[model samples]
Target: MRAEPSLPRHHLPPDRLAELVRGEGGPETLDLLLGGERSRRLLLLRMLDDATDLGPAWDLLSEAQRRAPQVVDDLLMYPQTGMWLTTALRRLRGRTPMDEPPLWVELGHMSALAAAALRAEFDFTIEVPVRHGRVPLPTLGCAVLPETEPWTRATVRAEGGRAVIEAAGAEVALPPTTGSAGPGWHPVRRLTVGARGRRLDIVLDDVDPYRTYPQPTEPRPLSGEAAAQWRRMLEQAWELLLREQPKTAEAMRRGVFSLTPTPAGERFRPRSVSAGDAFGGVEASEPDDAVQLAVTLVHEFQHTKLGGLLHLTPLLTHDSDRGKELWYAPWRNDPRPLEGLLQGIYAFVGITRFWREHRRAAPAQTAMAHFEFALWRAHVATAMEQVHRHPRLTPLGTALLDTLRDHCAQWLAEPVPEEPLALAHLCADDHVARWRAHHRRPAALRPSTGPYGHGWTGRADRPAPWRPNPRSCPTPRHAGWTAWRCSSATASAARTTTGSRSTGPRRPQPGSAER
Candidate 1:
């Protein structure tokens, strides 16, 4: 039998939802989201069980739940567990074959979760599959076995408060669950920081296979020095957030669960990603400073909050007329769908708020903070308008946009430094010009569904950022960017209905925008 919706019905008060959409939600909001996510986890487990034999995985989980309910619940909420079950079910249903990991390895994640939970409570033995001779216990670390095959089962037995793992007839005692991995064992490390008498424990999870989103990945376990570096940076970032951005800090404490560090990138501009499938999981390149790391957490947690909201209520659906429509996203080099625009808006709202608060918090950082806040508020404001009148937007989506509209209006009214604001205007104008060359068809031409038809047929005059009187014209001038069709399709106008205005200063860069 399949599991059904467990909560009476998941809901958020409109006022609370508005607060959440505006990126302020306390434990009450997070609790509802966590419960909703729990139901989803149970539903996926039932679906996987119905589709394929979960073997002893289910029984082990039940036993673990009996022994340590909180441990079982915590492991279930691990980002990778959600990722693994979601992919496993997709594969079992014969969908996304190329995108998902192998079914055998995917199913093995169940045993991994169960082992960690059961091993936490009872001195029990179980067998979990190993990949490339390394058995990964999700939320824990990987256990590398001797004489391992490409794929084989490892027996893990925990007794007398100690554990030993064996594969291919050779056994090794597990290393203590702190510091570095032993000669043949690697354990996941934890980072803990506290403020106001409450502790925040975050898993520095570089050893889980499902740590990466959309698919399981080979563990790029951080070396000792690298791991130590991550811990130091995280502690600093946490302290920064706690001291300067308490609301965001409390939110992160309530939501963010794990950090999976990618290879280091540029000193200042590190890359990061968050997936809807993995709530509370953040993957980021190593950062150069606590500020860089703090901002990344602030930005990614926006995606996390919105991702959680989406699981409870869909904000939009495919338009019957346009099917799957794509529109211009100011932040990107290409066109995006309405959903993407919403995600960006929600994230940037949080980002904009972060910089706004940072500017006020640290006097030395005000200049850079002002520019970021200005640039993002403009992008977010325009993006909000781009989807403001979208037909397919649901009521929940509308409310979200409306909340953003109110917030952006307040931001636009606030004064910004002239130098940074001017640069922000320039960047904003450059982006629109690039978008035009890439996607606009001459307005003279009738709307087309032609292959390669995203051009304006006639004279096209677009909006420029209101540099003259920004207070009066807060909505930046954006040209009527046409709907983009990658494979020769219909052209729908997005910002077309808004009247034309003065174009910004033009700098003719060589290359055309991406088609």
Candidate 2:
């Protein structure tokens, strides 16, 4: 039996110590520790003396698995170290033998080594306590392990050439096997698992070796049958808009209008998840006039086509802002600012088009009901910065930019309504009041004091960060203005026949604009 080593007096934070024990320490430290021929013996002695509790030791093992699971196999080289771990597991399980092969292999080997070394010093048998519980292990199988104990049991089911395991109130199914078989192992196959819950259903797949979850399906272009219907609807909408609004029609002919499809299985409303690009192929279930859907499609398509010249790039940047790295930038140059602006413009355009097409089918009040104005405003500001950077616009580009700016300005200028809903609500009275209070500042402080910080007059006409006061205004005048503008010249005639004055200010009634 090996003699127990003296404990070190050095102190380390729990997490840091866990990292060191897991071999995540820098190379200098690891190499030094492993340099000598008797390094293994030294390590075993040190670990036995240093590990005060099983928690830290368990953490060390877990971190080793996380950093490099293969390192756990290396522990076998130190017979005493392995025995210590096995003994620890047995103690955790109250001395009950582990029922699962994987668990046994993981714990038994380590404990056996520790027990062998301690046998000379202590004659009593050690019993480990285990707490029974189940957990969902994706792709492999469900396992029932003692939460407090190391002993565990697992029953895996084979269905549809996949392995199914249930644990932690989840059902996990592994992918079908593939590739040539070796003496004891086979090539890894694609693993897929689905967890059904009372309120949610989650599906995960392993397409990459690192076990990235929720793998995306390949982008599917419109099928022949679907393509025909899509084209027909687009053409009909285009023709109708062209005949009704010649300017809008001209914009369409000049390739100012764009179309894109959202990818399959993506949610547009209620919630959104990170998957493919923000916008891609359209979904079949999407409403033809869904403002959000239209905005996403048109915005993304614009990024694909005239993005270079317009400086409206996609939002897929590879910068390490938060958790991302610089390698994710889509273009050589940072195109996020330009893409953001385009996304905002496209969102507005899509919403406008939807309103125009479905005015009769859906009320104008309901338009832009679900849009978030603050987010859109931020996008507009981003685009405006790009435009300011490149102020000189071609005749065609100037016209398009002018139109977009005018639309955005009109929305901004209109009085924000009280308790407005959707992006348009930003133009409503109550919202304008809130915007003003929130944006209030001394007049001496130029527009730079607003959210945009840079003055609007600088370079390009960027959006002012100051939101209109919602309190000063009681109702949105823009919607009324738009309605009045769209009305026929005979509006006065109708007013006269109805014996009602047409000059009174209009107020948005409660719940009149819900989407």
Candidate 3:
């Protein structure tokens, strides 16, 4: 039998960083992993920037880089900002963030900043050798944020071992000292929330927010009220996570370092993206309330945890031939793949439970809770049913589905109010019916007597061919019912495979903002 690979007890242990490096027990795993050289605990604390004093370290690193010059390379090589960027880039790319390119970017920026700090020059540039060519440090737009302007390219002119960056009609000055916070902090904007544990970093990401999502328009910086609202909601989310979801809180404490905030009303609500993004960091918008944000956190964390586990093990066999067919997802207006459906099942399990608990804690909000509970529970059940039918599910995937079903048992059984229950039933039935209509092949029709009991002949005993009236058929977006000219059609022909009467709410149009 193959034995489990032995792990070493080192400063940066392999186990916790597995999510960071997406370790699969490969030879390069140790090299790629963040922690054997730097202490994992210290690194997390520094990123969190709450418990320990990183100011001194930042100053020392700056001084070292100034004196030795090579110290900048050493500082940049360490995977501190790399960990947060790993998560951010993965989310941006919809895949694992490439290690080398981002690392190069980090090195260039750090070296440039170091050069700026050492000299008293208002403008200086540092060039680092990249894959294509020697790219200057501190490029106009951020690596993640894409922008356009009159000046397309930026160039750096080096003279007498000193360089200057010239771009877009203005010269940039050296950034403020790295005393407490500034420049050297790079990717993360750490804040002390004055909360217990002070574990997770609530980074107000300056660089990533612009590029994190495809903005409705160009993502300008949040203004006064909007920025304050974002910060307040974020602190509240942290407190709520610590209070309600202790397990998730603990996991996030270890894994997440960055929380990129966006303005409200973005497509695809706050989600933990980048499957192997171990930074536990998720991109979210400032919600109307902290309670909603807490729920979003719980839901997305489910995806983050599952994404990490899936990367390590094969939960479902890769099916390239699955084509582009979109399956029905009640939670979303758009169709989804089996994987997206599975993600919904697991996420809604937590969302339902959140409302289940909310039903007791806040009586005034119980109605809304009951509605969400019934809505998501029914939807998750429908999704779970679809999941079982997926042929690609591996044993691990089956196990995960079983666990989700188990988690949802309590919420599924809990009674909802009649109004919300009816609504939930209507919505679920409508979605399922429409889905079947779109996918299922119609059954062959048998000859029947006409409405006036007339057959093909004048004999009443014989049957007659009939077609459905156009006015009677439902629209394509509604029930997707075929318009047939039939004079004699039985009610049974219209019934669904579930024996459900083909009567419910009509399907909402695709862009009706259903979710």
- RMSD in Å for all candidates: 9.7, 21.3, 13.6
Number of colliding residue pairs in each model = 17, 51, 6
Top candidate on TM-score is: 1
* C-alpha root-mean-square deviation, candidate 1: 9.7
**lDDT order of candidates, top first:** 1, 3, 2
Model 2 residue 393 lDDT? Answer: 38
Query: What tens-digit string does per-residue lDDT give for candidate 2 at 385-416?
Result: 34532333344444455556656565555442
Model 1 weakest 10-residue run by lDDT: 486-495
By TM-score, the candidates rank as: 1, 3, 2
Write one digit per residue (lDDT tens) for candidate 3, span 414-477.
Answer: 8776765655555555555454444433433632322322222333342221121111222244
- Candidate 1, which segments miss by more than 4 Å at Cα? 1-7, 99-101, 147-149, 176-180, 196-198, 318-323, 440-461, 464-515
lDDT of 2: 0.31
Candidate with top lDDT is 1
lDDT of every predicted structure (CA atoms): 0.70, 0.31, 0.45
Error of 1 at 255 (Å): 0.6
> What residue runs in model 3 are displaced by over 4 Å at the alpha carbon?
1-125, 128-169, 177-188, 209-219, 266-279, 324-326, 434-515
* Error of model 3, residue 35, in angstroms: 7.8
Better of 1 and 2 by TM-score: 1
